[model samples]
Target: METVRPVETWLTDMDGVLVHEEDAIPGASDFIEALKASGKKFLVLTNNSIFTPRDLRARLLGSGIDVPEESIWTSALATADFLADQRPGGTAYVVGEAGMTTALHEIGYVMTERDPDYVVLGETRTYSFEAITKAIRLIEAGSRFIATNPDPSGPSPQGTLPATGSVAALISTATGRQPYYIGKPNPLMMRSALNRLEAHSETTVMIGDRMDTDIISGLEAGIRTVLVTTGSTRPDMIDTFPYRPTRVVDSVADLVELARAGSGEM
Candidate 1:
């Protein structure tokens, strides 16, 4: 077990940790404000690559959380950041939506529909057989493969539906080349969040609802992780999962209480 030290930063999940289906979670806003007031650095780390950072920031503000557009970090942003870092001027064959294209474009990437240097996959509602075929061809022609996240499904009013990871898997199957995933569970996004915080992994804690992404990223980075039950952290899977968080709290309120107790602030 990694010894708990003075926390300098926090990487938080947005969907289940901060809000649930557009409805902000109780204590989320206040807790965030508290973190800010305490001068603790944090970022809203989300896997929803469907929306760009500006859109997501607006959504969060609309939900009543004091989220800055600049403080928001999505899988799209992570992918864009990664691409920019790896190959700034590389041409990309994007199979996602406005978020993917716009982010890449802003990072000075050249976007094309054919014979690109990279094949980047994200949540695309307009999945066509033609697009998949094109991606396969590009991969075979030696295009670098990249994926936003590994989540198979996303929560919706109708129920779970295919996410970006599903499409990325399809491309991987076709090309026999594994993709570099940029979202939670992958340290890529966490590294981006740490950069945003001007902090390193060792002094930061990753708090999220899902163990697969949040806890896994923390483990990979050798940091503390906190699982919140109010989000996607399932009950039955805790003990069974290979990675375990340092603590689990029921809600943001509970998290504050727990933190206070640990720091003798209560």
Candidate 2:
């Protein structure tokens, strides 16, 4: 194999690798600081499309992660990017929260209920029956279907709640039109992030917790992947996956030294 170059850009999953719920994982703050001080391009990625980057930044700050708004990327943003590329200035019937809507609006997409070009599905706390029904009808009436991510359920203080994938399934059953998902493990999300950063796969690293979504997507994108055990996938579960990440570690804390070394801080 050719010698792997030093990492010049980084793509990291936000929820599990950096913060879990409202709490920052240990050393997550230092990791972010290291990435910033390295002067290397990096993006914090998340599949949740409920909040805008600004909102996520505030939330991370509350958790003491201190991730900048510009360094954050979401499924909503990736979906919007895909749509904008597929059909510039298109019209869509959106069934999502501020994150999805804001991204679409920023991309010059018009959200409408009648005669739309696409029916875009995204994650939201509240999934209104009326909105879903409208999406089904619009899709049945010839509008294309699109979704942010394929996560079937999301965590809540109460419990697991049906997410975008579950709703997309319902709509697909009703309309017989499967949505084109734009998040991991689609690889499109990773490629889009790489493109956004103008980074090459040979010199980019992806740090994530999930072997299925994050690791798979990074692998597909040809980026080196690091599996951290701070989130969904435990260390013992790593061997269960057919494909493996380039490296595995206990947590972001374990990689802080590597990050610092990359920045010439050693």
Candidate 3:
């Protein structure tokens, strides 16, 4: 048996792990502060591509969690990074919000609805039918399909709303082509985050709530994964999955002790 490496950096999910709707999870702030104090490179990750990092930072700050803008990595950023690396200055027909558009623009990607090289799908509060139609047409015309994340639904104040994955499926059904999902469960997102933090997978730990997206992605990326029960997944449901996280806990609150212990403070 191989001994696990001590955690030197941390990657965590945002929605269920840190905040729920606009509220901070209990002790989330302290866990983030402790990571900063311990001098460990860390990032708060989200599959939602509707908001930019600055926007997310403001939202988290409002909830009493002071995560830096640079410390927040969105699927929008990951998609853009992937595009830039795969085809620099590529043209795409974008079907998302400011977060997705701004990231593509920063990477010098031209957004066009006509004869684009790619059709990028992302999260939006209001996904337009016309836009979906256009995306379907583009994909039929040989535009490569890409999506920010594979989340079928996202949380809302009223209830769950159909997200990028649902819309992507609609488009795929129309065009008979599936999208290359760039977010969690792809492992590409994890590698991109690790690259952004200059962290190694062997010495980094991934903390998230969802087993399908978070744990699977981390495990495939060759990092230790911890599933916190404070979010989408319940402790009872964990055993249903054949793969397992390195550890499980009630919430991010318990991670404070683990982080401290890793730093030799406990």
Candidate 4:
């Protein structure tokens, strides 16, 4: 196969790529350092919306991956950005966690449960009937539905917890309205990351473990993609799937080596 051009920016998945269930992946810290050393810009674009961006950054740092606070972007942030463009100053009835409220509020979206213009969903450990009922009521009042991502469950050391998608499903089932997701596998996230780097698809490479979300987003965004085997995307499943990544490595360490070798640093 012909060699692809060197990567200028990396749009990476957060949960499984950098840390899984709050534990930093092996060599994740060094991977960040290598990218910084190569003058490459990277951001953790994750579907998780349980924590604010600042909080997530602190969590990652505590786990040994030292990434800049602003270098992190969550589905909550992307959802807010998308809403800002579509419904500036609109009242949003949020059905998620602190992350969703923080982001929507920061973007000037008013929080309201009465006659809201939008229903925003994010990750939440507690998915009570009252929250879903309120969202359904707003939908019945003609509120547009929006969601962070389609991750049905979150991975953790303990077990998988129902994610935002599950809540979105409840609202959808109750009101017959499907939400617009602003996370992985959606171009909204890819666009947000690109805007941050001010770069084009030709020079950007997406690195992730999931084919459905990460690689699909990258291909849709018209960028090269590399899949690593350290997370949800199992090794035996890669060849069986119709989707393909530009390259597949064993870990983040190999990702760094691949980038450096392409740039003549290896």
Largest lDDT belongs to which candidate?
A: 3
Assess each prediction's global lDDT (C-alpha) against the native: 0.81, 0.91, 0.92, 0.84
Candidate 3, residue 34: Cα displacement in angstroms equals 0.3
lDDT of 3 at 256: 89
How much lDDT does candidate 3 score? Answer: 0.92
Error of 4 at 134 (Å): 0.5
Query: How would you encode candidate 2's per-residue C-alpha lDDT over 1-266 as one tens digit per residue?
Result: 96658888889998889987898899999999988887889999999999999999999999988888999999999999999999999999999999999999999999999899999999998899999999999998999999999989877668888999999999999888899999999999999999999999988889999998999999999999999988889988988889999999889888877776764311
Q: Tell me which of candidates 1 and 3 scores higher on lDDT.
A: 3
Model 2 steric clash pairs: none
Candidate 4 worst ten-residue window by lDDT: 257-266
Cα lDDT tens digits, model 1, 172-205, are 8888998888888888788888876789777777
- The positional error of residue 33 in candidate 2, measured at the CA in angstroms, is 0.4
RMSD of each candidate?
2.5, 1.6, 1.4, 2.0
Model 1 spans > 4 angstroms off: 1-4, 257-266
In model 1, what are the clashing residue pairs, if there are any?
185-213
User: In candidate 1, how many Å is residue 176 off?
Assistant: 2.6
